[model samples]
Target: MTPHILVIDDDAAQRRSLKTAIEALGHAVHVADSDQAGLEVFRRHRNEIEAVLVDLSAPERAGNGFLRALGDLHASVPVIVQTSEGATHHAVEAMRAGAFDFLVKPCSIERIAAAIDSALKFTRSGSQGKPVRRARTGTVGFGDIVAASAAMGRAVELGRRAAQSVIPVMLEGEAGVGKEMMARAIHATSERSARPFVTVNCAVIPHSLIEGVLFGQDSPAGSGEVPGKFSEAEGGTLFIEEVSELPAHVQTRLLSVVQGGEIEPAAGKRPRKVNVRLILATNKDLIEEVKASRFREDLYYRLNVFPITIAALRRRKEDIPHLARAFVERFSSEQRLAKPLVIDASALALLTGYDWPGNTRQLENAVFRAVVLADGPVLGERDFPQVMAHMASVRASGDTAGARSAVEVGHAAAAAVQETIVHAPNPAPTVESPAPTRAAASGDLSANVIISTDEAGNVRKLAEIEEELIRFALKFYRGQMSQVARKLGIGRSTLYRKLKDYGIDPDDPQKHAA
Candidate 1:
């Protein structure tokens, strides 16, 4: 049977656009221009509809009432909330009110495709009345993760080793760096692969209730019982997010669980023995947290037994193109396009050049937006309006560093010979001429080589010639670090290091103006 999607929005054009996109994904779509009409459509075809994609900004909906109304009709079907960028607060509220997922407007088709697929999967997994656990739930393996760079590869390799044992592993990285995904991969590959994997976000839980949430609460008057996260992951893996935010009391109890493999639910209750692997994550420096008296030192030691630090997106820029291309293919396939879309070299360069502070997640979202709104068979610079807009803004603000880097990348990509579309079979690999070095490529450097010998015809030190070339390139590129670095075949970080080593002021290129 074909999966059905119900789209509700007040704007007629948006409703039509969404319906077309959803139908292109091989799903039957039902559209409603208003909340009341949408409810009628859902009620009429309730069982047929597999998922609902509704806009939360509808004037008639009146504060998540539409979502509740849809739930009232049929609670099993997933509801994906959509809203304009400004309505982020409302979107968060809708999530709290049981939204399967929330998307900001102008979102890419790929984002929509991924969300719909996940929602349907969630529905199917929980169809048997078993509650679906969001601990990424035995889906992701190490192979599923994209680790093209050595930095990320190291982190993944460490995770693989940690999976061999029940050692409490700690993942340290900036927010949105895929720590949860790493944890899930560890669990999926571990000996307890068949058991449950439960997750608890310590940051969001109320401080007072965190203890009961992690350790399970005793029934009042000794009646029934509420199982905490620890109990839920018996013989499996328990992933605690933002472990640094855990209250001191909870930390003490958690330490006991780690040390003795048992948990005491209440003050007077006897310790209940349990077997489970632990994975904790934090965005802050655990040692600093301990120094500040915010986290426990002993508990930290136990969790940090097998620490894996995932590098930030900026530090691993080499992986951006790979991750972006993967997203493009995934999202394009999900949209069910007759022909797969390919990202233009310029588009790939623009993506690779930008520093994704939000890490791989942000890059994925960017690609999703680009793939969704793309009109032609190829995604170009115009397709990524947000990225181009940011570069434009940077240029306008006189921040030559970032804007020039992106421009340089675009220029380099313009000369790239490869244009292979992903998933294309029997594609012949093309080999090209070796790329010219920075000195050869630069007009000034190509015209004349720097003198390697001193006035007396004696050969100068290697550092002298290298520094002269760098200085010449810096001046030639007019202090554009990205262009200089790329033309020289080095990373931006390495370029900066060399600049500092040579005491070359990047901003003062006039020193070598000749």
Candidate 2:
């Protein structure tokens, strides 16, 4: 279908050019000479217009002000700002002010058409809409997480409420849960959405240099230095992932940043004040870490002011079908499949029944694998070999001795089993007990037996499962653990233990090898 486009520019030539190009694409076009004219056109044909292409350099009117005004009009029309040469900052400003996309001036019709296509796609998909004046621009919203389960619904509600406040938000979940996604959603729904949403994976960076990377370091004697995540996320959010991994000294500095909104650079430099909303995520139990004296109690309280725990995927199994469909749709679009991919009931059931150790990430990977491996347009149970295997293991584990079925009751059951096996109960159950029998029924028992000889043997099976789940959750949550855990329904401590146990490092193996 031909999309209706409105071109608004002070320059008659620019307006005419854009109008002509838009029309040439078989789209209906309208022209407005100024911001006033654009608003009038928008009002007159508000229903007809699909998008507005505005010139950022329109005379006498600040592009930001114009965009801001349009935002105030409650116009759902996607706005694409046209920028003059060397106006990169202006484009970003426009984006901050609710412009859906930007086009550099002196560009060919091809580029304009491409930008329009992208903007229209974004609009039609309901991805970006009317400017959320008070909402943080890039902060993730409920739409981003795509959860339908009651637990997930509550978590999302909490996220929205947390976003409305300025308090530091602490997200606790398993490694594969969509923590970062939730954090981003909170940012998107917050007042700081228009500003940068900087992320610092605490576990990824070296412990020796976290402070400098997070707070920024001063330039050496003659060289210039740059600001770090704190300054970069000024007026927006500083998302710290795996926050429990932060060293005690670094935690002190981070606490100061969160409490006082300032950080002193290295080499005795003066402290620089910033206005970044703090969003911390950890798969580890900070409370436990605090007890162990590894995490600062003060810092914990500061971040815990607005604590949000994401439900694990297994707990929110009801949302699996929807999530699976979303993933299939996403991958199918990305891959440009000949036909839209469909997931049959059995395949979806297979997905819903399995314990997603990796949470949504694993689910997405399973879907991606199914999409890629499928010979037909529809994805069937056979397509997800890993998912099927996991399902079999879970079923077998549950049916073997029926000792409150660890695989069926979710992570709580697994934790109970782990405690039973590791702590050595008074009656030290024999192999005939439901625990060992169930473990044996599940293929994981064999894997556990193999790793039992290792120093970390007891944690091995859980670690491997956690690693797989985290990796899987990464795919769906796009590596955001809070969301992964929320979808998975496990505590962050459980998630981290698995990561450490499995040794599934996120860093590039090639770089390490080199």
Clashes of each: 2, 42
lDDT of each: 0.70, 0.65
Alpha carbon deviation, residue 355, candidate 1 (Å): 0.4
lDDT of 2: 0.65
* Over 4 Å off, model 2: 1-139, 393-514
Task: Summarize candidate 2's per-residue lDDT along 441-506 as a digit string, tens digits.
Answer: 365543323233347545556655545556655443333344445667886556555554556443
lDDT of 1 at 320: 63
> What overall lDDT, based on C-alpha atoms, would model 1 receive against the true structure?
0.70
